[model samples]
Target chain A: MTSWQIIILASIAVFALKLAGYLVPPSLLERPRPARIANLMTVALLAALIVVQTLGAGTRIVFDARVPALIVAAGLLAVRAPFIVVVAAAATTAALIRLLT
Target chain B: MSTARSSQHKAAIRASVAVGIAVSAYGISFGALAVTAGLDIVQTCVLSLLMFSGGSQFAVIGILASGGTAAGVAAIASSTLLGTRNALYAIRMAPVVGGRWPRTLLAAHWTIDESTAVSAAQTTPEGQRAGFWWTGAIIYLGWNLATLIGALIGNLLGDVSQYGLDAAAAAAFLGLIWPRLKSMQPIAVAVGAAVVAALLTPALPPGLPVLAAALVAVVVGLTNWLGPKDPLPAMQQLDLGEDGFP
Candidate 1:
């Protein structure tokens, strides 16, 4: 597919996705099951996504110094360090790893 | 008369822009990387603008580069699945919008993970609504602009892998998820998913394992197999007080 086609398709898909939110009756959101699913889904999906992004890139875990960055990021997060710090620790760790290895 | 409320909103706008700038910088890396992966500049920018979801975009390009049609579908499916979480957030935020259609429209447009977190953390209703709208808008604008800029510069950037830009997107995702592990259940889910995905990384494509992991998370959550002792007390109580920002 051409770039335009991909863009158009994806845009339409996203709009449709957003529309679901607007169209759903607010009452449904009040239910315990749906609310439970919503809250759990964020953490669940996020965790899952991070795993795929970090470890699964076509094969073999890319566990080099990058893993250490995650370790530090998790540690900072554990301490409830500021958001900026957590991000910086990860980015800086990765950057240093790239520079060194 | 609520000067504090107005000021907090102002701070949210600025913070959103900051996040926008940071997140958009990665777009340059993505754009540059996509070009190297056989995507023309236009294709790269289009993915950024329309899909607007980083994980899925990376999955699509990665699959296409590897000649994997299924990869594209898997990536899109997983992304849409993850993106669905934003819809739930929208539902939660709706009441705070106070039935203002125009504001809702804008809120709907800009709603994303980062903006939602900020808005959800606000203590007041007005603050929540304002934070949601302003943050979402600024991030959206910044992200698109960054994508365009990144695409333009991508042609000039050679071998981004040397700088580890290839993994930068993943690294950013780590930053996003790390802050959310507030309890044992979340941490366990994260570790479990990561280990499983890592184990399956070689057997699967870039995005499939992620989709699988998400499925696992949902199942685990549904079964209540393990995790914190259900902090969601009064799950349906709608006590706007506790809802007053986490």
Candidate 2:
């Protein structure tokens, strides 16, 4: 399939998944375990994304500016800095580091 | 009605708008990155409009960028998996977003992280409604608009990496999940999954590593080992201040 086909098909599938939740029998979801698992799965996926974005370099793990920059972002988040602040600071930190080295 | 109650709703709405604006600004990064990742300006905006979930949107671009054209299936699978939480969120919000089929259908489109966090933060049903709809509408409008702007800007940039776009993406994902790390169990799950994914990144394809890492959450969550005595989904206890910003 072409890029357009892939994107269009994926978008529709995601929407359908979202709608399925609303239409499903609440009794099945009410079990709580499924909900718990779903929530945990989200965390897991996000954590994986963070690692991949920051370190993974196409089948190779390369240490680079993103590591220190991510740490800076974490520090800001720890202090309760706003969302935009963390993101901007991270980007700026990486940019500065890359420029210097 | 009590003035206090009205004020409560007002606060929720205010926060919703603030979150809307904040989350919407992040769309610029996505727009720029998506364009740089080979998606045209129109495709970028279409994604923001249709998928509507930030994590899923980012995953599509990120996977495609990493694994090249052959990674199309992985991109779709990873993006869909990311949307799983939204589906779960829908089940939780069904009662909160009650209406006819039409309204609920529309609500499903807006069933995203920021709206859910803001709504769950409220003390009253009216406040929840206000928070959900207001945040959803603001983000929906602002994200699409910002995507266009970012796409335009991305066309001018030479290299996104020099400007730390990659780092920003990582930081954004980190910040998004930061709020959900309320306890030891989820923290362990997050760390476990990260390690697993990192280890598998060199071995498996781009998107498969993320899918593989999901087992960490499933096993830990199912076993209830290193979990809380009361197994709550954590959505009901969402503190809006720390929630994953869309």
Candidate 3:
């Protein structure tokens, strides 16, 4: 299928999911699993995104200075460093280490 | 139900849309990277439009380019699996939209990362709905436009790193994730998931490790290892009133 076709199909599917969620009553959403899963999903999704970004350097998982980048980024976040500083520090650290090592 | 609340709703909508714009612009990095990786303009845009899920979109293209079809499929599956949470957001947000067809369409498009966060943060039902639609529309339009522009300019650029475009989305994502680490459970979950994802990276493909990490997070939260009661505060408990937005 063409990209447009794929997009249209996917859009429809996503819309359907939204619609289903809308139609379902809120009481159902109060289920332990839904609530539990939802909360878990939030943190997990963010973690997944971060992990993928830090590890996958153009298709391969380079465990070089990226590890240090990850650690530094997490530490900065832990210590409440400004967002831009934390990210710039991490990326610059990674690149410099890559160049050096 | 009240004018004051409606106004607050409007304000929340504006905030969500603004935040959406700020976040969605980061997609330029993804668009540029995808094209640099050999994906056509249409293919990259379609991933954004169809997948509409950022992590999965990146994972699919990343794996497909890496010659890891099986791993790519796994990544896509895992990311989509993690994406199930957005549906839950829809459940909470549906009441705010209240079956208005135009609003429903808006809600459908706006059910993304930023909008969900905005909606969850609001107290009033009206404000929540307003946030859901406004933020959703902003992200939808902003992301598409950025993707198109990024594809055009990104295709012309030699190395994306030269422009520092490669780190833009990661930076933006970190900005979003960093602010939410309020307490121990979330902090623990984030740390654990990151560690797991890192450990799995060399062993798995681009998306799999993250997904696995997310799965572990799910288990931790479900088992009360993450917290005792709900981590998210009940913003509605105070009876902010039908018209009061706070």
Better of 2 and 3 by DockQ: 2
- The candidates, ranked best first by lDDT, are 2, 3, 1
Instruction: Tell me the tens digit of each residue's lDDT in model 2 across B1-246.
Output: 799889988998898888899789888878887877778888888988988998888888877767765778888887887788788777767889868989998899999888888888888998988888999999999999998998888778758788987888788788878988988878999999999999999899787898898898889868877776875545553344534667
TM-score for candidate 3:
0.73
Which tens-of-lDDT digit does each residue in B1-246 have in candidate 1? 689878877876766566555555555555655665566787777677666665446545544443334355654565566566556666666676635677666566555655666676677777777667766666666767766776676567655445444444454456556545556665777777777766777787666666677755676667655644643542232222211111
Please list the residue runs of candidate 2 whose C-alpha ends up more than 4 Å from where it truly belongs after superposition.
Answer: B2-12, B233-242
Ranking by DockQ: 2, 1, 3
iRMS (Å) per candidate:
3.9, 1.8, 4.5
lDDT of each: 0.59, 0.83, 0.60
Residue-level lDDT of model 3, residues B133-177, one tens digit each, is 777777777777777777776689756444443343344345555
Better of 1 and 2 by TM-score: 2
> Would you list the rank order by TM-score, best first?
2, 3, 1
1 or 3, which is superior by DockQ?
A: 1
Top DockQ model: 2
- For every prediction, compared with the true complex, DockQ reads 0.37, 0.67, 0.36
Model 2 CAPRI rating? medium
lDDT winner between candidates 1 and 2: 2
